[model samples]
Target: MNESKHNTQFLGLLGQSSTFISAFSVAQVCLTWYVFSFTGSAVAVGLVAILETLAALLVSLPVGTLVDRLNKGMLLAVSGVAGFAVFLILSFNVLFFSFDMAAVLMLAVVWGASREITRSAGLSALPDVVTSGTIAKSNGIYRALRSSLESISNALAGGLIVALGVLSGFLFSAGAYLASALFAAFILLPFLKSKTATHPSGQEKKPSMLEDLKEGFRWLVARKGFFLLTVSATFFNFFMDMIITYYVIYVAVGINATSLVYGLILSALAAGDVSGSLIGGRLNLLKYSGKINVVLFGGIPGLCILAMGIVPGIYTAILFTFIVGLCFGISVNVWLTTAHNIVPPNMRGRYFAIDGALSSISPVAIAAGAAVIALYGIMVDFIISGILMVLFTFVFASMRSLWKLDGRVHKERPANEAT
Candidate 1:
């Protein structure tokens, strides 16, 4: 495939992905508001999150294997269709019937499964659609566009819910998923086929699914730096979840903010994400990725959250959260691009899934955070989470092996040997 054709097709896929993700964000916001309205407790929100994470965790390994074996475009289309169906059903129920917690929990499980499948498949398919040299830029573009759309959708969601009710949000969510399915089928699948045709085949026996799973684990274990990075990320997710699980509640109850304010705060964060992703793409951070990771991922985000805890004002908290989003946006692009540079195409799906599962440490963290909020209050939990995040940065940064690691140096090796 020519570079122009690859870029066009990749952009099409990304556009559809961005649209669906934006819609999902809107639906999520509406659902969160509904849950909070009904239960009036942060613990209920935490429980919902835990259920979703548990469902994703259950399917991660199997979905990883499927993503590697199946056609990536087809897998993404299926995921979209599943999301559309689920949301459509939810919309109908919400319109005609009363809100049912049990039904919502079941839908969350299905929704979470579909989300994980699509995300893994999309990330795994990126290398197949773009040249290696352009991976970081392409990833940055995708993130920037997605974040931009999310900002718009989240801002719209608050008004839509207030004016037209939650059913409208669910309808929009269903429509977006349907569009994603159509786009994948019509635009991405054909290009993927052409791309595959251009590659020269080698006669090698395919591994069993179990073998593939084991290989992914072994690859991560062999690369000490990457393994440690994953571990550090797991802890980061744990601490971050403590804050995120109750972020909206904190704004609503703690700071006495309204739904519009909640939406505006999220929009600010997404705007910052867009800025960071674009900037990160322009910088050459591969050589110093290790140090960059420690600062952007841990140092900046920790400080931002710490400031939020101390200030505890809506305006200041929004500024701090936006900065946190900006830093993480850059860190995410760098980390993902580095992974693409090192991981082989054949193993990327499983590798990403396993890494994703590791980071799905939200369930326990949400439970603990909710308990703390119940006991002491949101401020105490925020302060504790911020402290832990800052402390972990030093721990991650102190590793001499990780600091000396360079992604560009590793990129030269064959993927198998690089691990």
Candidate 2:
């Protein structure tokens, strides 16, 4: 009975999460593909990404503050509506005009900002719905499900584009986003309707937005483990950003892959991520904390990256990349769950924002990495990045004092205690 109830609640949350993610993933993939096809320049794609990241960086702190101070459900709902509006404007702009790249970039930037806000608010609201004891597994399941849905959605978008055309694909994506907004609006149906079991108290007299943001900053800085972890993880994030921005281009140029192949590779990565997320959730990470499991587990990806570079054939590389994806899925879910465990609930949004700001701005790194790859070679970048990520995992895991949150006062109270 307990398991059945857990499944029911989780599935309900998944319904809302999957819908938003499906729309976001599909629209983003279609828009990016449309731009790349039109321009035929990886640099152009990188520039648009840079603009979007810039928007996210600027808006992240303010959005985090809002998520901390305001009603999280309303904040999420407003962001969804804003995202729908942004997509509608983009669709109209492309439909009527000759498709100006500058204008399109602006729209994408706006969309990125909305996406950042929505994500921060939604994540901050999650603890209110689920207990900390289950947070790790819950996060793993959420990551896995979201990745799988995104994979399917991107594949569908590719098929739609091929059958109809880029214009129709954009329109379809826009409609899906609008539908997502409508779903998000239902979040206002009241506590009786949604009925979350976990709710942190003292939110009614929450601090001002600025104070909230400051509190988060202080929490991170005052904690030794968190500060070190954040600094170390930045390098890993930088490399991952470079990979996300350039992997499509790598396949297109190096492997001479078509749109279908691109979509397939993406799907493979997402598949790996899905598997990883599911497994990570079920794993006994606590049993092996500060052990070699952290680094050795992540070694799965490092080895996969090496295999991909040396594999020779596109099919073989795809298989290797899928394995790499699974490792990435595990690495991200585990790290996030671990961080959430260590950080206070009120500070999660701020720490997530800082993570977002660091990870989100990789377009500049993307551009630089691309240049370096072109000048030197893609294999070199892959090897160097994979090694660095593995190294960081080890270094971070060894920070024993920081890992325990010695400075911060979580009070170790029961979950039933009021905030």
Among the numbered candidates, top TM-score falls to: 1
Residues 256-290, candidate 2, lDDT per residue (tens digit)?
A: 77666767777888888899888877786543332
Candidate 1, superposed: residue stretches over 4 Å from native: 1-6, 193-206, 409-419
TM-score of 2: 0.84
lDDT of 1 by residue, 146-265 (tens): 889888888888878888987888899899999988888887877766443122257366667788799788888777777777888888889888988687888897899888887878
Clashing pairs in 2: 225-402
Measured over all alpha carbons after superposition, the RMSD of each candidate to the real structure, in angstroms, is 2.6, 4.6
Task: Count clashes in each candidate, considering only residues at least 3 apart in sequence or on different chains.
Answer: 0, 1
Worst 10 residues of 2 by lDDT: 189-198
Q: Report lDDT (CA) for all predictions.
A: 0.81, 0.66
Q: lDDT (0-100) at residue 104 of candidate 2? A: 79
